[model samples]
Target: MRDFLPADKARRERVLAVIRERYRAHGFDEIETPVMEEYSRLHAGLGGDNEKLSFSILKRGMNAEAIRAAADDPAALTDLGLRYDLTVPLARFYATNRAQLPTVFRAIQMAPVWRAERPQKGRYRQFMQCDIDIIGDASARAEAELMTASLDVLDALGLEGGSIRVNDRRVLDAMLDVFGFVVEERPGVLITIDKLDKIGPSGVVAELRDRGATTGAVDALAAYLDRPSSAPSFDEAGIRAALPTGIPDEVIAHLVALGETVAAARGADAPLVFDPFLVRGMGYYTGTIFELAHPSVDYSLGGGGRYDGMIGRFLGQDVPAVGFSIGFERIVDLLQDAADTGERSVVLVHDRDVPLSTLLALKTALIAQGVRVRVEQRAKNMKALLERSAADGYASFASVGVDTTAESLELRPLN
Candidate 1:
């Protein structure tokens, strides 16, 4: 969907390398899945709105009459669709490869997913997703490890002022139930609450009422929303203080334990926040959910959560899973440009009169000595040529005469 120039590609690869290294260090093995999957699977209800945005691949060998016959159901004409996100593919992958994988698998998937999104700042039709997932473990440890490794990525990128906002879908369910909302209204209520950041508390309440939600439930939630957001802390007290009483003890305890586990690794210094209204958009998230936040951005850098039921849909058996994905496009820009890489690479500026054999020999000799060598015929404007080389990340350049040996070349560092 886009073209990355040499310099752009280099920077991207450098950043990806750092992410892969950190994930691998945490014992997650990288995995790859195809860019396209069966159309029916992509349309499964798990993807939320992303399903509608998927790019479908029409079935081959369909005659004109066949295409027309299926016009009423355009989707029937398609056999596959480009993946809208990595999680779905990861689910299918585990389902098919479970026997070859460990009982508890930590997998890394760094790849591009396609969508038909109206491209915007930080949003693209095609972009890289850096995900680390743990499947087959349903405990808080799975969520904590995800949070820990995600935070570690931000730290490695030299990104500061980052924090993780935590919440549980069960907590929302408890809130709705406590407020007297019926099960049928849960999804409608969540869609409104998820807009709290955009519409604010009063707006969310007003919108719910406009949508003809139950009056008593709306009032109850309004009162709770009006309460002071000043939390006690990120511990059990904090979790309870943020939510009303009657929340299942296990939900509260699990969230508290997750915070404690991550804190133990990152210390109390860990930047974790408890946001009761945090609703990740994916319909498949069955339990704990969270997003990566930085002070500098209004949107989450990335987010993930527990989808303990998703793998079951694929494998026909329950496999607990949790994952975190870094917003590669968003965070890549946030990171300072990579440090200059000129030292290890060199440009050989040669006269046009130099023999091709001489140029190849010189290039080979420098490459053997662990340098990236590029032979360029000297342009009329030597300064322009040197500047171009520097822009390409060459650290220095040396002029190569026909008679000059690799050792005799004098290297001059580029400006």
Candidate 2:
């Protein structure tokens, strides 16, 4: 949805390289999937609102009549859609390649996904997503590993105060049950709950009634929301005391263990916390969910959660999965443009009078010596050419003439 100039593009890649390296260090292997998938799969109610935002691809060989006739029944027209996120396609990929992969597959997907939604500041219809997922692990350890790995990535990027807000879909469900909400209405209720931070308790209650949520359920949740609050903590007693107390002891225990594990792994200054209200938008989430937060931004840096039932939609067998995705576009802007260039990166400024073969020879020699080389013909404004080369990440430059050997050139830093 946007174009990056050379310098901006390079900066983006630098961030991606760090993410890739850190995830690999955590034992996740990188993988790629197509940008499109079967429209049926994308619309299978797993993607939540993203299904509506998907860019559908029309079926091949359709005539005007076919298109017109199928306009109302879109399934008869479009057979594929650009993927809205990496997780769904990953499910298909794992199902197809599971036999060749490790029993517990840890995979990385750093690629662009497309949606048809309206774009806003830092939000685009087409954007890069950096995701790391672990499949076949159902324990709370899986969730802990994911949060720790993501926090480590934030640390590597020098984005301070990056913490994860953790919650469980089951906890949301339980909270709804305790409040006497209808099972059929809980999805819409969850959607409204996700907006609690944006809209206060009175607003949620009013909107729920407007949306026809059960009256009793609305009043019940409203009552809890109005209760005096002590801030939530990542610890067990704190979590119990934070939300409505009856949040299914099993879930509280699970979250406690998950937080403890990540704390032990990341030590003090670890940025993990419990937010009983943190309902990530994706409906496919079957258990724990995460939303990565940074102190400098109002929007989430990125998020993902457990999708234990998603793969079964493809493989016909359940595979436990949880993933963390960094909002690549959002995070890239937070990073300082990399000021350091590789010392071996060099630009060869040559006069037009220099023979092509001689210039080629000089460049070839530097590259053979492990230098990043570029050959630039001298321009009328020598200073501008040198400045541009520096911006393009060339560290030093040397002039070369027809008779110049690689050894005869003296490299000088542009600045």
Candidate 3:
């Protein structure tokens, strides 16, 4: 089994507590789905490279010969696979159980998703995704709410000044059309330009040229995408002046509306910055897209966007949806680097003097009273126990001896 020592468990619990509190305060009901699901249902909404990563399974009861035969023929494989993300399964869940839920459904799910990816320092094959989504409305209000709630979650986790970069897909599409690029080539152009922050302008131009875009087109795209953060904000006349050639004024008006909505929703605490270059990696995003990044971190901590058509593939009907997922593992890694000293403590009772039942009861009571307690497993003297607790970074410890009373247990504050 993977090891989760006392300190690690404590830190994870603290982060989860903050996440749950912030989501619930915004009226999101907590729901959970099974980790494994039928492969068809899991893959129905996901497209492109996402389908290849699904971990499919076969029934265990099948005979060896039959299993071998099925394995040889891809069509004979069964339907089960591990869920890659929470939103797709949740969409299926809502469609199947719509009658039971309210017209407008808001849910917050915290669960692990499996991926067949190479493990690195902060990347894991199995990691938790903290997701929140709103369904049944196509209003900008839903988008604003999701963004506001996301800001609250990150702020509650101590990332107060982080930036939430946002951009509209319509704006990007209009720009591509104005630059004489076909609609079919938009994805390639977007994916390449999305990496501009990681790879510089020269690299993006090289990638565009390699993707069959002409040299002139590549130069224009590079200059457009390379607009620095210091570029001046557009006033009414300036916005009209910056409109792409041949695009309708109505489309530009819609883009202006989206920008105004986002700016108005942003509070004084966490300012929302308009990022024309922000395009999420997912192929399903059909509308406003966003990514959250810390000032000091090079990679995005989390991101999500509107995918109104993704769920329609399964239900065979349109459903309006928008979601944001927090990268819990990445956040944990960043927190490890920036973690300040915490004040919580756990007391370990000697197994010999304190029976397991009594120790559990004490723990439950203390927990109810807002005290964090951990029962000691290793056999050691009081001095060793105290030293171990201190080394684990605890601020205090409780000592339960044979002669200790319920009302007057010894409490030791660590140095």
lDDT agreement with native, every candidate: 0.90, 0.88, 0.73
| Global fold similarity of model 1 (TM-score) | 0.97
TM-score of every model versus the real structure? 0.97, 0.94, 0.85
Which stretches in model 1 have alpha-carbon errors above 4 Å? 341-343
Model 1 Cα lDDT, one tens digit per residue, 171-233: 999999999999898898999999999999999999999998999999999999888779558
lDDT of 3 at 156: 86
Q: What is candidate 3's lDDT per residue for 277-393, written digit by digit as tens?
A: 677777777777888878868888888888888778767899889888987887876676444247566665554756777777777877787766777754656678777776666
Clashing pairs in 2: none
What's the ranking of the predictions by TM-score, best on top? 1, 2, 3
In model 3, the runs with Cα more than 4 Å from the true position are 68-75, 223-243, 246-265, 268-270, 337-384, 390-395, 398-403, 406-408
Cα misplacement distance, residue 335 of candidate 2 (Å)? 2.1
Q: What is candidate 3's CA lDDT for residue 411?
A: 70
lDDT of 2 by residue, 251-337 (tens): 888898898889899885567778888888888898999999998888899898999999998999999999989989888877756
* Residue 67 displacement (Å), model 2: 2.4
